[model samples]
Target: MTNRKIYRIALEVEAFPGMPTTAAKLLPLLENHDSTASEIESILKYDPGLTANILKLTNSAYFGIPTRISSVRQAIVLLGWKRLLQVVMTICMSPLMNKTIPGYDLPRGALWQHSVAVSVAAEILVNALKIPDADEVFTAALLHDVGKLILGGFVKEDLQQIESMVTKGITFDVAESMVLGTNHAEIGGQILGKWCFPAELVSAVQWHHDPESCDESCNLSDIVHVANTMGIMTGFGKIDQELALEHFGPVADRLGLAPENLEDMAQQTADRVKKLMVSWA
Candidate 1:
């Protein structure tokens, strides 16, 4: 199908049921640097479902907080607005990301696993490299492959074509673009754009597969690109190995990281993902 047709279909089906209205409302507010904790708690209070999810996650084994967080206000104060927003987004998006995507050969929860892995890896990179805005990078990494959720059926439909191209040495993203008229990263960007996400986030999702081609200089896209590759390397998901390696050296160099950093980051990311999976479970 044409890209336009695929985009149309994505628009129709992209309104995932798990996306809490409260989370949607809170995104812009959280994006504002000046947004106060009270403001965040006020928005979350009205959505009991969202509040419950946040409380559950904050009190999850992943957080290791001793006392139970019974109230949204308490959770907000404990987590702070930045981390609280991350938890909120994670809880809200989990349902959609956790679903099986047979087209991409991701069984139930596989995509979510990969997403969390990348998010963890991105967080590691942010700290190690001293990159600014940890929360933004983590959020972008978590949603980087959202296009795959939208393009699963199309990827499945074009599986044979995709595999054939891969066998002939073409990368997965290229094969996807060739067969489906658009790749997941671009499709994911469009979906996030429709959700009224920030342009930087949309760019990160869109250009993650090919960060070098991004209109702007190195940014979160480069970080997520390396993180996504690390996630696949650590067995969270599948990708063309050769294609992924091509970016590894360039991205690592761009970030001034050595090969050893990636190896350590991958291990750290796996351990963190394992702990976080319990909450999702």
Candidate 2:
């Protein structure tokens, strides 16, 4: 399908079932460098379900706080604004991402697991490399493959052809483009733009598969590219391994990461994913 057709399909879909209005309202607050705990708590209060998820997550073993968190404000205070925003985004997007995507060969919850893994990996890279805008990168990583959700049925239909191209040495995204006329990365970027996400995030999603194509000044796409590849290697999901490895070295180098450092970061990301899975459970 053409890009226009793909976007038309996305627009016709059910408004992405798990996109809470609360998320849209919370975006500005989360983006604000000086946003207060009370400001976050106040917005979350209107969404009882989201508020409950936040409190539950804050008290979970993953957070490891000494006392239980009973209220949104208390959770915010305990988790701090940045961490709280991560939890909220994870909670808000989980339901939509947790389902099976047979087109991509993802079983129920597999995509969600991969997303979490990538998010963790992005966080590790951000801190390790001392990159700024950790929250934006994390959120972008979590939603990096959202286009897969949109393209699932089409991919399922074209699976054999796409696989054949991959077997003939084409990268997965290239195969996807050949078969579907639009790759998941670009579709994901368009979807996020439609959702009113910041341009940084839209660019990250759009260019993660080919970070070299992103603007020279932004490292967010490069960070997500490395994280997504790491997540695939760690078995969060399957993809063309050769294609992934091809980009691995260059992407890591772009972030000034040595192989040893990248390996350590991958291990840290895996551990974080393990703890996060428990919290989700």
Candidate 3:
């Protein structure tokens, strides 16, 4: 895990720039608090692929409705708008959200699974706290780790050094800085910002690991951070000796999430993830 290897991997990942979905049109639609079912269906209609994906997902293993859902309108009526929106967004994001970075020992779809679990966990946590705009909360959760696709190879290239630092209890962020020259959080933040996502969502992705630096108390980062740690421990994300237990308790305390409550939230979140994958699949 030398700088040379790290740079080499970073170059490969950058050489093949990703093409994410055109989300701006959908973003405003998602932001519409009072949007009707027809409105949501109309907005997604712009992308036939997105619409087809959603319909296919609604009939997937996750939802398993009694009848097939062959259209956006039918899916919306069957799944409810909130759940339908979640499925649509997941479909919209799936293409760009996938990659393999063996540095983290993540399998082909491992990172995607981890991200989905964490996103669902974050939303569950938000509901337990009765936070407002729960849809927006989940949206932020779903997109938080996108930066990892860009930086995972960089991290993988230096995997050995990262492992070495972890053995000595060094932080991933600190160890990465020492080896990779730039950290994933910074890279992730930059990507989100460049995409012109909601400023708050971008901020959460940027600062998820460090709750103190996040812009707001009720931000999605705090929720995602807790969800991510729980994902690792609960087996959604890959577990490594590199875990920083020091980070979790503080983040939980900051968000007024008690240990018992956090435990229940994690369980519920994992359950929902099972149902969620059906639609995504």
**What is each predicted model's overall lDDT from 0 to 1?**
0.80, 0.81, 0.70
Q: Which candidate's lDDT is highest?
A: 2
Which stretch of 10 consecutive residues in model 3 shows the poorest summed lDDT? 13-22
Sorting all predicted structures by lDDT, with the top scorer first, yields: 2, 1, 3
TM-score quality measure for candidate 1: 0.89
User: Against the true structure, what is every candidate's RMSD?
Assistant: 2.6, 2.4, 3.4
TM-score for each of the candidates:
0.89, 0.91, 0.83
Q: Residue 91 error for model 3, in Å? A: 0.9
Which scores better on TM-score, 1 or 2? 2
Query: For model 3, how does the per-residue alpha-carbon lDDT over 1-281 read when each residue is reduced to its tens digit?
Result: 46676566456545644434545565566566576777776777778887777778788766768898777778867897677667766776777676675556676777778778877787777777776655666666776667677767667766888879877978777687778776666667667666666677777777766767675644577777787776665577755522456767777776788887767777777777777765555
Please list the residue runs of candidate 3 whose C-alpha ends up more than 4 Å from where it truly belongs after superposition: 1-19, 34-43, 59-68, 77-81, 215-218
Tens digits of per-residue lDDT for model 2, 179-232: 888888888887888788888899999988887778743578888898887787
Q: Which runs of model 1 end up more than 4 angstroms from their true locations?
A: 1-19, 241-243
- Poorest 10 consecutive residues by lDDT, candidate 1: 11-20
Candidate 1, 44-134: lDDT as tens digits? 7678787777887898877788988898778767777677778877887887788988777888888888888888888888888998754
Residue 25 in candidate 1 has what lDDT? 84
* Model 2, position 30: C-alpha lDDT score: 78
List where candidate 2 sits over 4 angstroms from the true fold: 1-18, 241-243
